[model samples]
Each structure stands twice: as structure tokens, then as C-alpha cells.
Target chain A: MCDSCGCNITPGNRHLVAEGEPGHQAIDVLQHLLSANDHAAAHNREHFDRHGVLAYNLMSSPGAGKTALLEATLQALAGEFRIAVIEGDLETENDAERIRRHGVPAIQISTGSACHLDAHMVHHALHDLDLDAIDLLFIENVGNLVCPASFDLGQHRNLTLLSVPEGDDKPAKYPVMFRAADAVVFTKTDLLPVFDDFSIERATRYLRELASAAPVLNASVRSAQGLAAWLDWLRDDMRALRARIAGGEAVRPAVQPDGAALHAAESAA
Target chain B: MHELSVCQALVEQVVRVAREHGAGSVARVTIGVGALSGTEPALLRQAYPIACAGTPAEGSTLEINERPIRVRCALCGAETDARANRLLCGACGDWHTQLLSGDELLLEQVELAKLAEAI
Candidate 1:
């Protein structure tokens, strides 16, 4: 039977079957599925630079304490850095509410069924938040280590978290996320003594293998251990972003009386 | 889980490719699913149809080529296919094995057909 017309067709005209019709020609296409997401992410990066906001995309598995780390970060850096958050979740605005309680502006982007937050969604959330007023922007990506690694959220840096309870083999199991991350945070260190699953040496070795130069920070948000170091790293990042802005290395928004800067000024007033 | 999200990306890529080549519809998309890529082929298959809905590649078939995880043992000069759940080299009981393949998630090729011309 012919693939095209379901008739008993010979092999000589099988090209037609492959083509589907007489005029129909088959074209070979080789492309990456993440191309669109990558393009959008680049645009988002430009948007962040224009507003002088240094964005960080945070990724981790559920119960990796990403929210807790953010909470502690918000508390520690509130006075020093003008921070804002865009929280992504499968459901609920709970994470956003938590961040908002810290007095920092936050917007919840509920993906509903989506596993990861792509660049387009982040772009929309940026409009709602006063980007100019924000020195640092943290995008708490949906708590899935696997899918989020494939999609770039247009952030300047990507941070992946792994908790002690999740075991030390995560870096080896989920290499893509570890390889893509600018930094890896080992969260829930306070529980390390209780759990035989986590191994610092093994995890560190695996992380180094996947991401050679990526910094790994071990922290326990519950105990406030290593929180200062995390904040210090953030401060350094913000300082570098500010320097880039001041040196005209970054794209600055056009000075209109009605743009983001004006909006931020008005809000401050 | 996350495989569903990846399937969505795959569908979008197929549709975009079909449109670019003036293809009426996509027939098949050949993707390379690596063993250590952490994507489940079954879950991806389940998600493909839902993701392709309302897209140009709606009825296209997803052909996944599962790439075996190949690793080189550090202790011994032997390369072997590593198991998905276990990283140990079959040739030698060595934990220090460098991965050679099976981490890629690529849409290697897309087959599309143009519409028939009106007689």
C-alpha cells in the first residue's frame, strides 16, 4: 500500500509516498528544540542590562531549601541590596507571598502544569516589577532540577541547589543542571550528620567534574551557617553589575520622563 | 515529569522546522535521547501528542534514538557502555569513569512534507 494514498504502490514511486504528494517535497531539518528558549533568554538578558538588574535563575529539586535560602538572603541583604524576586511554581503564590513579607517586591509566576519557567514568562514578570529599583533580581525557578537546566531564563547567573537529604549522587545523575549552573549550593548542611546519604567529598568531586570552575557553597539556612558567605558572593555580584552599568558597558534605558526609572522614582516618592 | 516539558520544546522545534521549509505537515522527528540525559522516553512519548496539539506537527511521529551511556574507565584503558542506574565500569570496578556519550538531548532531524499543488 502506498503511504501517501493507501493504494498498492510500487517502490519506483515510493519517493512520492515519502513526499506525501506530487508537489510535496521533503526537506531535512536539523535543529535544537531549545533554540527558541535560548533566543528569548538572550533578549531577557538585554532587558535586565537595560534596567541595571543583575538577575539570577535559581534551580533545585523540591525540599532543597531554595525558598529558605531566599528568605535568609532577603533578610541579610535587604539593607545592602535592593532585591526583588520572581517566583515560579507549579501552583500557588505561596513563595511570592513569603518573599513579599520580607518587604521586597515579588511577583508569582504560576506555571500551573509547566515544569520550568521559560524566558517569555520572565519577560512578562519584569514589566510588573519595578526593574530600575531592583539592584538584584532573583528568579526562583520551578523546583525541578532536570527540565529547568534546559531552559535559560535570561538571567546573568544560574544557581542550582542540592540538599543533603537528596543525596550526593545528584550531580552525577543530573549532569546537565550541574554543568549549566554558575554555582552549586549544597543546602541543608545541618542535616548532614543525620543522613548517611550525603557525602561532601563525593558531591564536590562530581560537581567539579561536571562544572570545572563553578563555585560550590555549602549552607544551612536553618542554622544560618554559610549564609554570610552567600550574601558576600551576592554583594560582589551586585558590585560588578554596578560597575558595568557605571562604565557604560551595560545598556541603559533611554531617559524618558515616563519609563522604568521615572516609575521607580515615583514609587520612591 | 520534566520529560513532558522537553516534549513541548521538541514539538515547537518540529513545527518551526516544518514551517520554515514550507512543509504542510511534519511526518517524523528523529531525536537523540541519551541514557544519562535524565529524560524518560515513555513519558516523552506520552507528552508528545499533548504538546503538539494545535501545532503544525500535531500528528507527527516522535522517533527517539536512545544513546547508550558509554564511559572510559580511568584505571584501565577500557571503554564500555555504562548502565543508567549504575556508573561502575563493567570492565573494571572503577568509580572514576569519564563519560564519553549518552548525555545529549538533540532533535537531529525532522521529516516534513509540502502540500500537493492544485491540479
Candidate 2:
């Protein structure tokens, strides 16, 4: 009997029987499975560039205060920056509704069973907004530390967030997310006094060990700590992006691994 | 798991390739999965059969090749393996190394069975 389906043939006959056939052939594909998604991401990048928008992909574990940080960012910088959001979630338009309450245009992408938002989903969300009218676009990916890190949504920057209550060991456990981040935000700082296990030093140490160039900052919507630095980072990035856009270049961060420690490491060397 | 989605795409690609080649059925599909590709091979293997169900590629064997992460040391000019969640250079213990491999998700090859000769 065949091993595969117990047919009236020799066991494990598929490979042998197929090879013996007259017209059987093997073809080399050598294709990346995500090539289609990458193509869509390239298109999304072009769209953002043409409209002079600085797009950011925000990733984090669930309940890491991604929405809260965005709310704070919009509240603080809305006067100077025309901001919009593409909120991704498994369900509920709650995030979109929250952003809309702040008078910012927002689009909600409900992935149903999908864990991460692919570039195609972002591309579809783009149609709901006037791209030229917005200066910055934030794609808040579904709250997943693992799956979201592997997918790129054509954002100019990839931001990863970790709340203090979630502990400082997240960087070590989810290194892929930290490695891909352009910036890391430590959120819910107001609870740090209660959560003793969370240490900025340990988190920074992990980042250093990974040789990451992403800058890390702590913020709390309650205390407004580090909000200025967060806003300044955005402002600097927006300026750099606009300059690149005007020069017909892709809006990449001017410096790789942009952070205080990276600069210190370079100087020490 | 995300493996289900990946397998779905894999089946789609296999079917498309089979159609392009005018083959009646797929005999085998070989995939190269990287260690750091964020995919669990075990889960993927389990999901493949389900993804192939109701498709022309059903019952096709999925042969997976595990690709190890390779990092090139900037200081020692040595290429070595990168352990899980660790990105340091295997040689010279330098943190400033470049990743050379282990993030790929490729559909390397496909074996197609010809239509059975008219009997």
C-alpha cells in the first residue's frame, strides 16, 4: 500500500512514481513568499513620498498604550502638525473613534482573524484620507509583538512600544521587534513606581547588546513625562522627511541607529 | 497561527505554478524557511495539509529546509551562526556584526506530475 494514501502501490510511491512519468519535471521557483506584499509596500512608499507624508508603523504588545501615546502625541502637536491615523485591531473601531474625538481624521482596519496589518491593508486605508493634506501618517499595527515585526507597511519609521508594567525583559524576549524599530517607546511610566521589575537600565542594556540604533524614551499620558522629547523626535523626523521629499529622495532617517548611546559608542571607539 | 496564512499563500503559489506549467498535479513543493523568519516550521507543517485541502495541490508533500542565521563579524571577518534571540558575532564576540542570512521565506522548487497519458 502507498504510504501517503494507502493505495494499491508500493509505500511512499509518490516521488518514485511521479519521477518515472514521461512528462514529469521539476521547476525552480526561488521566489520569496512575501514578494507580493513587498511590491505593495513599495507602492505605498511611493504614495507617501508623492504626498510628502511621514508615515510611521507603530507596533507593540496588547494594552501597551499605543492609542494613549497617539492621543497624547496628537493633543500635544496637533496645532503644528496635520496628523492622521490608520488604526489596526482584531475588532472594534474604538481606536479610530478615540482619534476622531480629537478631531483628527482616522481610519480603522478590522483584520478579523489576521494578526498583523499587511501593506495591502494600509494601501486600502490610504484611499479614505486626503494624503496631500496630512503631514504625518501613523499606522498603528495590531497589538502583537511577534507577528507584526515581520511585516512592513511602507512606513518611513517603525516604532515599537513597551509599557513599564509589561516588564523590561520584553526587548530580550522579542528581539525581532526591537531590532526592527527605528524608535522604542516605554509607555505607562506613571505605573513604574509600582512596577519595580521594570528598569530602564536593563532595557537599554538589552538594546545595546543587540547593537540597535533605535532611541528609547519613556512616556506617560498621565504624567506627560518625555512627551516633549517624543514630540521633538517627531518634529525632527518630519523636517528631515520634508527635506528628502523636496530633494526627490526617499524619506529615510538621516542617521542610522539614531540614539544617544550609539553616538557615545561611536565617539568612544 | 500565522503559519496558516503562510501555507495558504504557499498553496496559491503552487497552484499558480502548476497551471503555468500546464501540469495536472503537484508532486512536491520545497520551501526554505529561515530560523528568524518568524515562522514555526512545526506549525507550518501542520497547517500545510489544511491549506492544501480542496486545492489542486492537495496531498502534495511539503519539504522544508531549515536555514540557519549567519552573521558576518565586522572585526574578525568571520561568518558564524547566530543563536536564537542573540545577534552578536560568533567570532571575536563583537556586537557590531552584519546579518547575512536567516530571514528568508522562499518557495525554492516545485515538482509537477504530467497529465496521465490517455489510456
Best by DockQ: 2
**Per-residue lDDT for B64-105 in model 2, tens only?**
877788888887889988864677888778777777777668
Residue-level lDDT of model 1, residues A1-269, one tens digit each, is 44456576543443344555455456554444555665566678777887777888899998799999999998887688789999999899889999989998999999988888987899888889887798788999999877776666677778889999999989888776776677789999999889977888889877655523577888999898888888787777668667876786632211111112222343357
- Alpha carbon lDDT at A135, candidate 1: 77
On residues A160-242, what C-alpha lDDT tens digit does candidate 2 reach at each position?
A: 89999888988888876777788899998899889988899998778655657678988888898888988888888778778
User: Lowest summed-lDDT stretch of 10 residues in model 1 chain A?
Assistant: A252-261
Positional deviation of residue A125's Cα in model 1 after best superposition, in angstroms:
1.2
What is candidate 2's TM-score against the reference? 0.87
The lDDT of model 1 is 0.74
Clashes of each: 0, 1
lDDT of 1 by residue, B57-82 (tens): 88887877777788787779688876
Clashes of 1: 0
TM-score of each: 0.75, 0.87
